[model samples]
Target chain A: MASGDREESKCCFKEWMTTQEEDLSELFQALTVEPENIDQLKQLAEKSITHFQDYIKRRNKLAHKDISAYFAPNWCSPWENSLLWVAGCRPSLFFRLVYALSGSEVESNLTEFLLGTKEGYLGEVMSSTQLLMINALQSKTISEEERLTMKLAALQEDIADQPIAMIAKGLSKVGEMNGEVEKVLDNHGRQMVKVLEEADGLRMNTLKELVKILSPLQAVDFLVASKKLHLCVHNWGRQRDQKLGRKEIDEEC
Target chain B: MASGDREESKCCFKEWMTTQEEDLSELFQALTVEPENIDQLKQLAEKSITHFQDYIKRRNKLAHKDISAYFAPNWCSPWENSLLWVAGCRPSLFFRLVYALSGSEVESNLTEFLLGTKEGYLGEVMSSTQLLMINALQSKTISEEERLTMKLAALQEDIADQPIAMIAKGLSKVGEMNGEVEKVLDNHGRQMVKVLEEADGLRMNTLKELVKILSPLQAVDFLVASKKLHLCVHNWGRQRDQKLGRKEIDEEC
Candidate 1:
């Protein structure tokens, strides 16, 4: 990988960790909540944990998948060491959280560990609680690119609260490109985006044409062409994590 | 990355996880011995846990350093995201072991957590016993290459015990241009290790002749060139693991 790729990987690791700590801390708090119905709560938590264990086992396959991808060409043994080193030194934190929550159930988890690699040692966490934790967090997990795309789509929808003519104003001749209609809105829900006050009806017609040609999501991506979704993802993560931390213990992920 | 590299990486991960499970299992057993000792024992374990945490931090930095090295000629976020992606994962087994051991210290280990990562978290387990467990493991952690070399060395040593002088002598002539010595030893001792047999007689002369030519370890490495040190390391691990497990309370690395 190039230097840039390596740097991106590091950033990815850091981000992953931050997310993990939040999940675990939240899990701990839930464990401490003396629920009004202890017996019922225990049953539900146990079930969640079982589900999480399954999720971990699936993710374990990921380690094998990534490393094998790296070693396809030369078939040399030296490179394998790097992947192994990584595995030994740092496993997926998500895996740990699930395993931790499962607590005593870990012993059983080993028997279920099934990866194509058929590696000698790494099974997985045994308990059910840890598994639940894994599943819950994993559901929200998405790559940086995917996360960004999702948010940009959201942002576009947010900006769609405007008249079509007003939203189309930015387009000089967008109809031929995506055959779409525009409905961009200003912060105060004004028609600042769709229609260009200077371009007259020509601008609005072109903008509307562009919007109609593109899918709703595609239109948003095009509208924010020069921008990245990182900021939006981060904002979403913050709000989501807080909600996660405050969630009830027995709720399904 | 190709299919082969990915496969190799996956194998390594599995092996690593296996080793981790084995090691932490040892530590866990150790901590459980004086199960009732609780807080006092936890304080001691905490020393080890703290060390383990430090090791994790340092390991991440070092791993990143390698990526940084690879990217020296090019620059753009240093490929940190990828690095972090791998680094961010936990040695799940290790953390699980830590959390489990804390069970004995129940009240003493339970304490408030502090936030470190912006949106995530990091918190102290409180008990010294937990820290001790972490520290003890860190003290023994070795990188992948060192581990593999050790394993390979041990295998070589085991293989050397077998005798086969004809093969060794034949090896000297066939494609010997590579300067590779294939010393097939006898089950007992013999012609294959002719150099070994002649060593004692030539020992004094050889030392005098090459006193300035080698470092002590290198010399030893050469002497045991056919002996596989890897097996020795593996064996050490097995025996030590057994002892730790049986004892159920070792805090020493």
Candidate 2:
């Protein structure tokens, strides 16, 4: 890849992050607006989802040539990279967020009113049916993650037995690696890209499914929370990097 | 990390690779040299191991601040990153290399003479005892990989429930994330560094044990093969990257 192309990919991700900040601000506005502007909230929520889809599309294009870049993206902070799975956040995170948000709301209501209520106002944010569906989606997503992880393990193992082995044998005989070795490595790269694509597919599907399960207002709240967490983590990672005496990436770049 | 420091890490790794190339050349020279310099071969093999240990130590220090860089290291090619386990190649890969080299020797001997040979010259490169030991080591390494992978999975899942959830709650209440959120992320980063350290330990131990299991000449052969494979894959990855129109990091830089 050309250095220019690499910079382009980094810029692409940075732009996406900037868009995320904008989306979060808009989401917060929708959440706090008077008269419960349901149409505005719904439109903003859908727009957020569309924006995510577009970002994924752009990422997929870059990943086809350099998927490893995403897996260990230099654009993100070390702290953020440490938590990454398959190049981005885990899809099942949405379920955990729902449970956490609902649980927190319930706890706050109890503390405020001292009532033994089973549910809070926001508790109905997720219906029992929605919870069941989300739970099922979570199970499926987790299992998919496990499957991809094992596949990755196998791929890592193959590194020694396949290309490395062939190259070793060729070197021992001919004093150099042959062209076939390159082909083998390229094949391996293609498989890695496939695993990455599958992972991205799971992430996108999980988000869409979760959004589908929520009411427009609830979805806006969830979106607001999700974006807030993302932006917060990014900023926090930058702060931690600075404290650790690490040079942070230039946001403008 | 500062761009210069990042460049230093890359240079550190590149220097290591240059050493590997030199080592491979020496190993092959040792293999083909007359009078079979056992002392020289053993010294070279030991030096190779020591170099690896030193590299790991240096990497560990860097990882204390930016362990994620190792996991998704830019110093390596995308192909190399695709196969990385815990910031480097899998420890179990050594066992596979032993098996492949031994298996190929056996096959070539069988085909050369059309005789049902019980054991070829290189077939005994690993004795029954050594094979048993290596098998044990492989199992241990694989199980260790599994454990680390599971730990990573848990860590990824915790991202949403721990830091993200807390940040979300804090933002909803106070219109901003609190300092506590950064602490949570810092804690997660520490755990990640620990996991990377464990993986490096496993990799070093596996190499040491495998070397111990082989005769000096056999060890030289194995080392030669290993280094050749390493250099080949790295070069292959770079070529592939170039062919894919990706920007390659300048070698001098």
Among the numbered candidates, top DockQ falls to: 2
> Which stretches in model 1 have alpha-carbon errors above 4 Å?
A1-253, B1-26, B60-65, B68-86, B90-253
- In the range B139-167, model 1's lDDT, one tens digit per residue, is 33323222432333232233212122112
The C-alpha RMSD of each candidate to the native structure, in angstroms, is 32.2, 4.4
On the 0 to 100 scale, the lDDT of residue A68 in model 2 is 64
TM of each candidate vs. truth: 0.19, 0.83
Give the runs in model 2 whose Cα sits over 4 Å from its true position: A1-8, A34-43, A111-130, A168-179, A239-253, B1-12, B34-43, B111-124, B127-132, B168-181, B239-253
Q: Write the per-residue lDDT of candidate 2 for residues A1-253, one digit (tens) a residue.
A: 3555667788998898889889987877767753178788778888999999999898788777666667767677766776677778877777777777777776767676676544223454557887788788889989998898788777777877844675655665433436776567567768888888898888888888887878887788788778877776677666656655554443456
lDDT, model 2: 0.73
TM-score of 2: 0.83
List, residue by residue over B62-169, the lDDT tens digit for candidate 2. 776556567666666666666677777878778778777788776766676586543223454557887788788889888988898888777777777844675664
TM-score for candidate 1: 0.19
Model 2 clash pairs are A1-B245, A1-B246, A1-B247, A2-B246, A2-B247, A3-B247
